[model samples]
Target: MLIIFSIPWLVWRLLKTDYFAPLVVVQIVMGIVLGPGVLGHWFPAYYEFVFTPTVVHSLNGIAWWSVMLFVMIAGVELDLGKAWQHRRESGITAGLALGAPLLLGCGAAAVLLGFDGWMGPKAQTWQFVVGIGMACAVTALPILILLMEKLDILRQPLGQRILRYASLDDIAIWGVLALILMDWSRIGKQLAFLIAFVVLGLAFRRLMAWLDEADRWYVAPIWLALCGLGADWAGLHFMVGAFLAGAIMDGHWFNQEKLDLLRHHVLLVMMPVFFLSTGLRTNWAVGGTEVFAAAALLLVASVAGKLIGVRIAARVLHWAPGEASIIGWLLQTKALIMIIFANILLDKQVITSEAFTALLLMAVASTMLTVPMVEPQMRRSRALAGSAGQST
Candidate 1:
């Protein structure tokens, strides 16, 4: 863990390129380098000693809980009511942002199906296509928040608008994931679980309303565990349940400062283990060229599709000229959520390790590109807006 955390910090400090590649992205890259693909290959005995089966198992447990907490926080943080208040703009932007990349990514997935190492054994053609498509469309809401905070825009009107689009897309991304993961054989249980969850969700909300803030925090984890277990038992996976667990709860129940601190601490302390575990899963058995080629394809599809979609929305909505580019690049940021999405796909045997590696690379590259691409455009826009206001 020390090695995992230290390497990324050292790189970030030495390079001093936090604007281009934040510590999180560096950590992700370090995970890949430290995985069997690099470190394990160069120093087999050290890699084996450090990441023995027992140690890997421990890391997996930490990764699981860490991601669960993170996902739940994402769910709770969603400002659905605000999105609904601006329904038309939010709906149009969110739909275009999500749909365009999804279609392009599906096309890419179809192309990949011609190859040997991309599809999992259990995945149907549609599942693979849709899963990959959703991956391309995903915006890592948590990471988006972190980046916006770093860019000093988290409280700005523009930032809030972007958050609305991302929040809606976040909901759709998980819904699509649930659809992809639907077990036909377990349909009965799944339906029952949904029904029970709705009823229990109402009860849970009431319970939360009745509880004091301190008590609510205390009961939150128990609620998370129960929901997660129930969802997994119904074949939907615990992560889905974790998301649902928080999505139903009102963020207003908790102090905003406290929630933010919890999120920061989770990322600080626990998410590195998750990143390392993610790296450990990376495999290059399908050949590095093929993996990288696939990554490039997906990255292009993700970036281009996002830009095109947002441009279309801007045109229709009559947004100012440079706004689409800024929004598109920002929305294209995907790291933690997309990785988690791909991890679930790999776990369910819907995508091969090769596909997972490609997705991982795509996510890292996409995230790294965001701040650099958006900063200048955002500054220009702000300058233009300021001049217009002064002239007025």
Candidate 2:
């Protein structure tokens, strides 16, 4: 753990990687570098010595709970009521933003289908395609929030608009994941879980309403654990349940400052283990060149698809010049959530480790590009707006 945390921290600070990648991005890169494909391949003895089966198992437990907490926080932070208030705008932008990448990514997945070592053994044609497609469409809302805060626009009108679009798409991403994970054999259990979720959700909400704000924090984790166990028992996966556990609750029940702090601390303390664990899962048995090629293809599909979608939204909304570029780049932030999505797919044997590795690379690259690309576009937009104000 110390080695995992210290290396990234030292590199991030010494090299000042945050101007482009941020500490989280650096940590992710460090994880990949430290994983089996890179470090383990180069130093099998050392890798085996450090990441022994027992140690890896312990790390996996920590990673699992960490990610569960993170995902729940993401669910709790969603402001769907605000999205509904501006339904037409939000719906159009969110739909386009999600749809375009999904289609392009499906096409990319189809291309990958022709290749060996990409599709998982259990995945159907449609499942692989749709799963990969949704992976492209996901926006890491937590990471997005972090980037926007760094860009000093978290509270701005423009930032809020972007959040609205992202929040809606976040819901779609999870819904699509659930669909992909649906096991017909366990359909009855899945249905039962849903019904129980709804019934119990009402009770949960009422209880939250009745509880003191300070007390709600303690109860929330109990809810998260129960939902996680129930969802896993039903074959939908525990992460899905963690998200649902959060989504059913109202954000207003907690103090915003404390919630934000919780999120920050989670990212700071726990998520590094998740990153490293995710990295440990990467496999290059398919060949490094092939993995890189697949990653490049997905990167183009993800980046181009997001820009095209947002540009279309800009045209329909008659947005100001350069606005689409800003929103598109910002929406393309894919670090955490996409990794989590791909992790789940890999967990379910819906995609191969090679595919997971490619997705991981694409996510890191996409996120790294976000701040560099959007910061300039935002500056240009501000200048244009200022010039127009002067003219008026």
Off by over 4 Å in 2: none
lDDT of 2 at 82: 95
Residue range 138-194, candidate 2, lDDT tens digits: 899999999999999999999999999999999999999999999999999999999
Clashes of 2: 0
**Cα RMSDs, all models:** 0.9, 0.8
* CA deviation > 4 Å runs, candidate 1: none
TM-score for all models, in order of appearance: 0.98, 0.99
Best candidate according to TM-score: 2
Evaluate model 1: give its lDDT.
0.94
Q: Write the per-residue lDDT of candidate 1 for residues 218-241, one digit (tens) a residue.
A: 888899999999999999999999
Please list all clashing residue pairs in model 2, or write none if there are none: none
Error of 1 at 333 (Å): 0.5
Cα lDDT computed for each candidate against the true fold: 0.94, 0.95
